[model samples]
Target: MYEIIFNLHSFLAYIVLAILGIALINAILGLTGKKDFTLEKDFRISLFALILSHLQLLVGLVLYFVSARGFSAIQEFGMGGLTSAARLLAVEHPFINILALVFITIGWSKHKNLMEASRKFKTIAIFYGIGLLLILSRLPWSQWF
Candidate 1:
């Protein structure tokens, strides 16, 4: 069960990263080009990114409970005994990821209220960009490669 959930969480991370990257690029282009925020493309891209990220959050939560490097490490080590690697997986990764999701969610909600294309693009660009950066900062890059 642990292995399965871990694998699923790892696999879903790719999807979440890819979608967020594409969404960020799209938002940048929309903002720079001053393009209209069309429902067909912009909306779909943002919505897809949002949904995939939420799914990843759910999977990550499950993995946190079941993975050895997650809750168990913290429970056993109390906090200080956790090696850098263990700390990354057990605490930093999850915490930063949750924060990224918060930024993404705020971006999505804010864009909906904006009537101007520039404002919508700006909201998504700023919020999603920050979220993407946060996720990148804490990813287990060594393990991933």
Candidate 2:
């Protein structure tokens, strides 16, 4: 069960990052080009990225509770007893990822209430971009390799 959930979480992360990158790049391009936000493409892309990212978060949440390197690690080590790698896996990654999701959600909400194309693009660019950066910052790069 742990292996299945862990693999799902890891696999979904790649998809999430790809969609988020596409959405972020699209927003940046739209903002710079002063392009109109179209429902067919821009809206769908952002929505897809948001949904997929949330799904990844959910999977990660489950994995965190079940994996030995996650919540159980903290319980075993009592925080101060943890090494840097263990702390990253057990705490920092999950916490930062949740915060990133909040920023992404905020960006989605703010974009919906906007009337101007530029403002919408700008809102997503700044907020989702930050979210992306946060996710990247906390990723277990060494573990992946």
Candidate 3:
């Protein structure tokens, strides 16, 4: 079960990052070009990104609970006793990813409330962009690759 969930979470991370990056780029282009936020394209891309990210979050939460490198490490070693790699897995990565999701969710909500196309694009650009950056910052590059 742990291995299956771990693999799923790892695989889904790629999809989540790619879609989120595309959504961020699209938002930036829309904002810069002052393009109309079309339902067929802009809305769909943003919605897709949002959905995938939430799905990733759920998978990650399950992985965290079940994986030995996650909460179990913290329990076994205590917070201070953990090595840097252990700390990253047991603490930083999960916390930052959750924060990233919050930013993405806020962006989605704010974009909906705004009537202006530019404002909507800007909201998504800022929030999702930050979220993406946060996720990138804490990624365990050594383990991920």
List CA RMSD, all candidates.
Answer: 0.8, 0.6, 0.7
Predicted candidate 1 versus true structure: per-residue lDDT over 8-124, tens digit per residue: 988998989899999999999999998999999999999999999999999999999888889999999889999999999999999999999999999999999999998998899
CA lDDT for candidate 1? 0.94
Kindly report which residue stretches of model 1 are placed more than 4 angstroms away from their true locations once superposed. none
Q: What TM-score would every model get versus the actual structure?
A: 0.97, 0.98, 0.98
Q: Is candidate 1 or candidate 2 better by lDDT?
A: 2
How many clashes (backbone atoms < 3 Å, residues ≥3 apart in a chain or on different chains) does model 3 have?
0
Pick by TM-score: which candidate is best? 2
Candidate 1, TM-score vs. the true structure? Answer: 0.97
For model 2, what is the alpha-carbon lDDT of residue 58? 95
Predicted candidate 2 versus true structure: per-residue lDDT over 1-145, tens digit per residue: 9889988998899999999999999999999999999999999999999999899999999999988999899898799999999999999999999999999999999999999999999999999999999999999999788
lDDT of 3 by residue, 6-78 (tens): 8899999999999999999999999999999999999999999999999999999999988889999989989
lDDT of each: 0.94, 0.95, 0.95
Q: How far out, in Å, is residue 67 in model 1?
A: 1.0
Best by lDDT: 2
Task: Name the 10 consecutive residues with the lowest summed lDDT in model 3.
Answer: 1-10
Candidate 1's clash total is: 0
Q: What's the true lDDT of residue 112 in model 1?
A: 98
Question: Residue 102, candidate 1: how far off, in angstroms?
Answer: 0.6
Native-to-model Cα distance after best TM-score fit, residue 60 in candidate 3, in Å: 0.6
True-structure lDDT of candidate 3:
0.95
